[model samples]
Every structure is written in structure tokens, then in C-alpha cells.
Target: MQIFEAIIGHVEKRCEAKGKRLTTQRKLVLRALIDANQALSAYELVDYCKQYFGETIQAMSVYRILEFLEEVHLVHKLNMSNKYIVCSHIVEGHEQGIPQFLICSKCNKISEKIVAPETITGLQSHARQEGFTVVSPQLEINCVCDKCGQ
Candidate 1:
């Protein structure tokens, strides 16, 4: 994918398969995720929501929708920041893999990098050996990008 968005063809197939409604609120939330191009806390999402979804939607409503989207693998949440972002690859065709987050500490921009299947498998196996099953490795580190470093 180019970044944070659904390939419309793929998303439509998924929605049909799941029998889920892509309500206006869901579209609004997804748009905000795409536009922000970063992990966004629900509160931040709500701030954007007011513009299109109106003041009627409480934060909890947004959270509920986000929760549903995540459960269905339409979006992924980075627990490190307790924020959500659109998955780079929207389809989880084969019980696939967790998407890794490349987050900028200085500007808070995020880039989703698809971890290789071998890497995820090895990590999961290692975690299982330690009696811990790791779900997200959206690691946050302190560093500046070349532009920021300059």
C-alpha cells in the first residue's frame, strides 16, 4: 500500500465477507486515520470527528467503533501509545502477521512496516518459549530522521 488506506477493492471484499456496515462514522474515522498519517489517540480522533461526524458522537462511541474495526483486522492499534492507525495491508488473508510501527519521536509521524513472516514466526516462537506471547512490537525509540537530524 502507499501508506495508511484501504485498497478499495480489498476493503469492499472484506466488508462483504464480514457482513459489516461501513457506516458514515466508520468512514469518518478511517479518513481521519488516513489524513493524520500517525497513531491517533481516541481523543485526537474525536477532535477531528467534530468536523464531519459532529459533536453528537461521544468519545466512547468512537472507541466502540475503533474496537470493532480492530477486532475485524481493518485497523490496528499501537498499544505503546494507546493509539490506532490504519494497517498498511488491510487484508489478513492467512492469519498473517503483526505490522510493525516505525514511529518518529520528534515529530510523532508513523510509518507501518510489514514484518517478514519468518521474523514474526521466530519472534512468536521465542516469546512462547518465555511463556509470553507478544502481540505488538510497535517500538518507540528516541531518534531524529535525516530532516529532523539536520
Candidate 2:
């Protein structure tokens, strides 16, 4: 609980630095994502708010909040899963990196990894060779986590 509060404080400070306000609704949505510790759709976040926080937030509002959060680097959207997760770097007090998500196919657990810049460059080079443009270097890999694999 203390750690969660500290993370919230950090987020607040970050927002203030950017001259953006972390409104109550945004905080609620962030809290829900942090508490869940997993990727969640916008509607799932709405349900989570209602179920756990006893606050009613519409899906549209949640989506807007998510967009804001993503813009500020406080959250990330897993495009492959069409879900969102709080940026692990923010929670862990680390600098942001090019993220790669290992999504467990069996248990739905997601592990976030910060990969080397060269890896992204290599991918971009490969895409260029294929006459393709690489947009959004984020990678989502599907695999079974250790626990689930066992």
C-alpha cells in the first residue's frame, strides 16, 4: 500500500512537471490498472472501478483518460491484446525504454522487458529491406510463463 501511494505521488509529480493535471478520474483509472497488475480493456477498467472502488465511470471517459495517460508515458496499450497496462518503468522508478511484452498464452500474465536499442534498429533495418516502414517498435510476444509452462 505504501508503495502504491509512492507510485501515485511520483505520477503526480511527473504530471505537474509536464504542466498537466492528474485529475481524480485519471487517478481512479490509473489506480484500477495498477491494482489489477495486468492488461485490461477500457470496459474492464470501467467495471473494475465500479466493482472495487464503487465509482461509476463510463467507458468513453476511461478511454479518454487512457489516451491522456498513454500520451504522458504513464501507461501503455498492448495493441496485440487490445488492453492497457501501467508503465512498469513508472511504477519501478526506472527510465523508460523500448518495451517488449511477454504475454502468457495460458495464464494471461504479462511481463514487461526493456530491450536494447540495437534490437529495434535491427528490426527497422529488416523492415526497410522488405520495403516496409516500421512504426511503433513495441513488441508483444506470446508465450507461456514459467508457472504456466510447468
Candidate 3:
């Protein structure tokens, strides 16, 4: 939570090293995601970008940047709701580890937890025992919050 700035800095450095232009729009979008504790959809991101950045920021451009961010592990795409969230870790590549999403369907609050290597191994072993190959850990658990229950 307190280390988003460090992650953004590292990402910027990586982009620089790769000779990729760290465009203003890209920075803004990533920053918005970093600032938002909850996952945001592209539409939400586009709206925020347009509001804070003015009308010059096109939705298509936002989508493109979001896709690139997702590709590079700077962000993770939530399959349950088709939203995007900044990765819990600033990993170099996207598909290195199994990402477990703790999502609340009622309030739409999302928390990401990275599966340890051993946990993954155990999961794989269990899957193998069941004659099934585990692919992804995109978990979306539905529940009612305390406030909502009251």
C-alpha cells in the first residue's frame, strides 16, 4: 500500500531502459490505478482520465495503455468483473505466478494475494490427483458486507 510510488518508479525505469516512451497518458493512468485502492474498469479509468486530464485523453488510448500495462505485469486484469487492478507486486513479467483475487461481489472491493510457490505446487498435486490440470486462480467470492447486512 505504501510502496506504489516505488513500484511506479521501477516501472518507469524499465520503460526507459527498454526505450519505450513513458507517455504522459500512461503515467496518469497508472498513477490513477495506484491511487485507487479498488480495482477499476477501463470505462472508470477513462472517465477519471478525462475528468482529471481533460477531453484530450481518448478512450481508445486509455484502453491501449491499460492493455500494455496488463501485459507487462504493471496491472492485472480481473476476469470476474472485467476490471483492471494494479499488480500486488511490480513483477517484470505478467504470468510468473498464480494471482489469487479476493473479490467481494456485493461491494466490489477486491484484494489480490499472490500464491506462494509451494501452495501452487500443492494445488498442482491435488489437481493431478483428481486428474485435472489447474490453470488459473481467478477466484470471485460473493458475500455481503457488515454494513449491507445491517
Best by lDDT: 2
Local distance difference test scores for all models: 0.73, 0.91, 0.75
**Model 1, range 86-141, lDDT digits (tens) per residue?**
87666555553556776767887677676787887887799899999776654444
Q: Over the stretch 52-79, how does candidate 2's per-residue lDDT look in tens digits? A: 9999999999999999999888899999
In candidate 1, stretches whose alpha carbon ends up further than 4 angstroms from where it belongs are: 1-10, 52-55, 91-96, 135-143
Q: Indicate the residue-level lDDT of 53 in model 3.
A: 54
Query: Which regions of candidate 2 are displaced past 4 Å?
Result: 92-95
Each model's TM-score?
A: 0.76, 0.95, 0.72
lDDT of 1 at 49: 71
Could you give the candidate ranking by lDDT, starting with the highest?
A: 2, 3, 1
Tens digit of per-residue lDDT, candidate 3, span 32-123? 78877678888898887677656456778888998888766688888767788888776453454778876765787766777788887887
Shift of residue 15 alpha carbon in model 1, Å: 0.7
- The candidate that wins on TM-score is 2
Which of 2 and 3 is ahead in TM-score? 2
TM-score (C-alpha) between model 2 and the true structure: 0.95
Q: Candidate 3: list runs displaced more than 4 Å.
A: 1-7, 17-20, 91-96, 122-135, 143-150
Ranking by TM-score: 2, 1, 3
